[model samples]
Target: MAVLTVPITLVQAAKQGDKVAFMSLLEPSLEPGYRLACGMLHDSQAAEDAVQEAAFKAWRKLGQLREGHALRPWFLGIVANECRTVRRSRWWSVLKWPKSEHPVETSPDSGLSGIELRRALRRLDLNKRMVLVLHWYLDLPLDEISAITGISVHAVEGRLQRGMSELRRLMETRDEN
Candidate 1:
């Protein structure tokens, strides 16, 4: 399902001490947030933890959100930062890596294809992978992605292009196997 952009009214209401409203604002961003966290962290449990922490931080910092601003980008920024924190934890590396979560119902070829795609994605540097996932998977607009990533639109564009080029090359090489 496509994640709808959070309504500006919800953003305003959430800023005014409305907990329900605050959660309402976050509702639309939840699925996208989870997907982002999963893509970044590569672990369902870690993704959930990251999203939960980010949601808590988003609520606490709701007041800091400016009136009429796009909540999705700002909120996504928090989620991205939370994922970074999770990845940086010393224990994160010492622990066993997450097991592959193959799709239960997919055809064998498609399932293997997905694994290959994910592996290719993981090979990209975080900065490039981040832009590719946000733009392709999350379907976020360029300006919103730029804002969330704290980079210029031009830079976002550059990263998206370079990331896609690299990802394509990796996939082609894998297909030769």
Candidate 2:
């Protein structure tokens, strides 16, 4: 449900060494940027870093942004790229010890009280996680998610459906337990 209305003139101004314009251009995206980073990284610190890095990248590439195109997806593409970079740097070690090897067990009084949902979400492959986060948390449409992640629209839709189904199953199992 993000409706970006910032004008191309603002972006053009930002591209022409206008710091305030750039800030204005970047402002609306800050919240979703953090959310996307946090959901994908699942670590507050890493998420912050990812958002920071994404902001820098966006600044660097602001000129490449097309007129009339919304900025959110462009910004998200940067965040997703940062997440991939950070994740790849640790790919070897993480692959050696997959997080899914041991599922997260929830307990009563958990603040995240819906720990099963979080666990199941975390269990999904990175592509599925990205799709789910963009579609569910960010409320991005499948076309927008596909644009942000550079995947096919159908692929994004499939991942979202699969991720939701998996999450539901996990929640149901947790309730039964």
Candidate 3:
């Protein structure tokens, strides 16, 4: 596979213990990682924690990143794994995940749409949700999404179709109320 736009020089420098290079290399992925975690975990703090953990792990394993690999999807795969870990931890049941402190900026007419969309998205199963979020929200292609989720491209397409259907059904159900 072709390498993502992240410069090979940056990757090489990062591997040689260059903190600045590592930070620069990792910067592009931060928001996408946070967004993915937020959609998965539904709590800003947990999402932040997950992203932090993923970044740390990525830094530690910087040497393992293969040449010609797309860094964004690969790093997101790590973030997804971190989210799964957070979900499975013993204390997860006891912990109360907090709501997002930052208010979403939406036009008056469209504000309700944002809320409805989020609710509909929350209704999806993790597998379906990840596929949907990775594809639509992050603007990743089906093949890139498959790489991040460790699923086949066909499975990703199926999940995307199902997820969109479910989201539409959910939004329509809300409209009936």
lDDT of each: 0.83, 0.79, 0.85
TM-score of 1: 0.85
TM-score of candidate 2 on Cα atoms, chains taken together: 0.81
Full candidate order by TM-score, most accurate first? 3, 1, 2
Regions of candidate 2 where Cα sits further than 4 Å from its true position: 91-113, 170-177
Best by TM-score: 3
The C-alpha TM-scores of every prediction are 0.85, 0.81, 0.86
RMSD of 2: 5.4
Report the Cα RMSD per candidate.
Answer: 3.1, 5.4, 2.5
Global local distance difference test of model 2: 0.79
Taking the tens digit of each residue's C-alpha lDDT, what string does model 3 give over 62-170? Answer: 8888876878888999999999898889999797766767633345876778878987887888789888878877788888898899889999999999999999999
Query: Model 1 over residues 1-177: C-alpha lDDT tens digits?
Result: 223456777777777778999887888788889888888877787888889999999999988777657778888999999988887799987999666564213345767788888899889988898898898878888988888899999999999999999999999999887
lDDT of 2 at 116: 56
Off by over 4 Å in 3: 1-3, 103-109
Q: What TM-score does model 3 achieve against the real structure?
A: 0.86
Q: Clash pairs of candidate 2?
A: none
Q: Which is superior by lDDT, 1 or 2? A: 1
Candidates by lDDT, descending order: 3, 1, 2
Off by over 4 Å in 1: 1-9, 97-109
